[model samples]
Target: MVRISEFQIKDVVNVADGKKLGNISDIDINLQTGKIEAIIISGTGKILSLFGKEEETVIPWKNILKIGEDVILVRFNEKNEFHIQEEE
Candidate 1:
């Protein structure tokens, strides 16, 4: 188990395709199980916001590719294919 404080918000996340997803804004946890559940990311740019109006994206833990000292890399599911979800 790792402390969430070890990571920072607004850190960039990436995919295998080298596509920039966004920055991590928050993490979602399952209160019932007391387990880390998802990673929330805010959109990286303004163009995406104009189309989708994304506030943030909740990505499941299973999708995480790697967790580095300063950044987190993740892969989102096909069902929730968000180019970028921004935080307001």
Candidate 2:
């Protein structure tokens, strides 16, 4: 079994655009069901800091295609669009 800590070190990549979405910074979990809801990626950029904007990329668990040894492959869908928004 793979531990959640293992995911923190693996790189997350998008198969649709071949974009490196960075590593897993955090995860959303459903306590009731004991299931992962999404993977959270921390944003990076100089401009983003200047604007006081810190957004995170949230990839739904359903979008994950495969979990490899070094990388996690994810598929992009309308419901899983990558975006930068203000962190709440």
Candidate 3:
């Protein structure tokens, strides 16, 4: 397993079908296991900020594509990808 320190927040995620999701807001950590549970990403669109919205979508850490020192790449399930839009 890799260390969380190797990854940074606010990194962009590229999904299939050319849908570009937003950046990482925070990370979900498992307190019991002391490991990263998932990566939280902010909702799409600029309108969210105006409405005081703070919705975040969580992608399992295992689904991550790569964890770089500067950014993180993640892949979301295609079928449930639309669920992220409603959460916003």
What are the lDDT scores of the predictions, listed in order? 0.67, 0.83, 0.63
Best by lDDT: 2
On residues 1-88, what C-alpha lDDT tens digit does candidate 1 reach at each position? 6765666543656575666666666878889998778777765455544555555667888888788776778876647754444444
Better of 2 and 3 by lDDT: 2
TM-score per prediction, in order, is 0.63, 0.80, 0.61
lDDT of 1 at 4: 58
- Estimate, for each residue in 20-81, the C-alpha lDDT of model 3 and write its tens digit: 56676667889999788887776655453665545567788887887666555677775664
Kindly indicate the candidate among 1 and 2 with the higher lDDT. 2
**Which TM-score value belongs to model 1?**
0.63
Model 3 bad stretches (over 4 Å) = 1-10, 45-52, 81-88
How does model 2 fare in lDDT?
A: 0.83
What's model 3's overall lDDT? Answer: 0.63
Tens digits of lDDT, candidate 2, 40-59: 88777434356576767888
